[model samples]
Target: MNNYEKVLVALRRVIRATDLHSKRLSKNAGLTGPQLLIMRTIRDLGEVTIGTIADKVSLSQATVTTILDRLEHRNLVYRVRSTQDKRKVHAHLTEDGADILARAPEPLQEEFIGKFQSLHEWEQSMIIASLQRVANMMDADDIDASPVLDVGAVLREDGWKETKKKAGA
Candidate 1:
């Protein structure tokens, strides 16, 4: 194949890998990537505000609130208005949430991060630059994105439903 075809193939593989991992996570852990991420953040931060969780996860507060609402519906998390400040609410993982999180597989990015970090600094920079160039070439350089590596409309509460519909699942 030509170099450009090779690049396209590599990008497709990355997307497919992310899609497959997301499916596995949803099947095994019963949580989407963003859901697990938000829950884990709440667990780690110990009664964190939605804004704080949003900052920690590199997602918008509105997106975080949506995910939290779903989690709350599932009884995985609960929020309480701070007594010291009624306007500020804190999120805490319910017992079920913590239990599910403990059993959930590690996020796909965590595994990638470990391997990426092992490479030489120059290699890391080259990879970053190359990916940035690819993004620019595709006119996706200015798109809003977060650190979450999940595929689909991760910003929406019904994102997975839309993905499934697109795939005719």
Candidate 2:
């Protein structure tokens, strides 16, 4: 294959790895990456507001709220209204939350982050620069993204089909 084809294949493998990991997490833990992330944040922060969790995780409040709603429904988290400021809501982890968290698999980035951080400063900077350049080359530099490794966090129930329909409409 040509250089371009080789690059494409390598990229696909990386993407596919992420996709497969996401599927495994969903099947095994019944939690999306963002959900696990929010759970961990809640556990770490004690009683934190939705905005705080969103800021900590680099996710939008709306997205966090949506996932929090699901997590709350699952009884993994509960929200309490602030007594002093009744309008304020805070997230709290439940017993089940703590138990599940103790068993959840290492995050998708756990291995990657460890190895990436072990590289020398010069090598780290070079990788970051190269990755940024590749993102720009692919016209994805400014896309809203979180540090979470889960791909298609925004997709739900064949979002692609709906997007295709809208594009052709």
Candidate 3:
């Protein structure tokens, strides 16, 4: 196959694997990858502001706030209007949040991160450069991507409902 086709196939594999893992995480633990990530961040950072969580996860504050809304609806977390600074909001994990976190799967990036970190510095740099080059070639440099590994676009798309229903069944 041509290099472009090969790269597409590889990217497809990576995307599918990520989606499957996210599905497993949700089915088994009732938490999306991003939800689990926010929970873990709150746990690690200890009652931090929404901006802090956004910064920690490399997600925009609005995206973080939206997810926090979902999480709050599910009673996994609560937001407190900071007394010291009324404009600042802090996120705190509920008991249920802590328990879910205890049972949650590893972050989707954990394995990839471990292996990536094990590579030589030069190899790591080469991979980063190559991936960025591919992204540029695909005209994806302007996309608002985050480190959250749940395949958010696919998950939110029209077909995702049918796909998720079938997967859940």
Q: Estimate every model's Cα lDDT from 0 to 1.
A: 0.88, 0.82, 0.83
- Estimate TM-scores for all models: 0.91, 0.86, 0.86
- Model 1 spans with C-alpha error above 4 angstroms: 158-169
Minimal lDDT window, size 10, model 3:
153-162
Q: Distance from true position, residue 100, model 3, in Å?
A: 0.9
The residue-by-residue lDDT of candidate 1 on 78-127, one tens digit each, is 99999999999999999999999999999999999999999999999999
**Clashing residue pairs for model 3:** none
Better of 1 and 2 by lDDT: 1
The runs of at least 3 residues in candidate 2 whose Cα sits more than 4 Å from the true structure, single-residue gaps closed, are 155-169
Q: What is the C-alpha lDDT profile of model 3 across 1-169, one tens digit per residue?
A: 9988999999999989998998899888898787788889999998799999989987667667878898899999999998999999999999998999998889889899999999999999999999999889987675556777777732352334444455563
Q: Per-residue lDDT of 1-169 in model 2, one digit per residue for the tens?
A: 9988987898899899998988888877788888888999999889899999989977778778888888889999999999999888999999998888887876788789999999999999998997788888997654656788887864442333444555563
Stretches of candidate 3 exceeding 4 Å from the true structure: 153-169
TM-score: which is higher, 1 or 3? 1
Model 2 TM-score on a 0 to 1 scale: 0.86
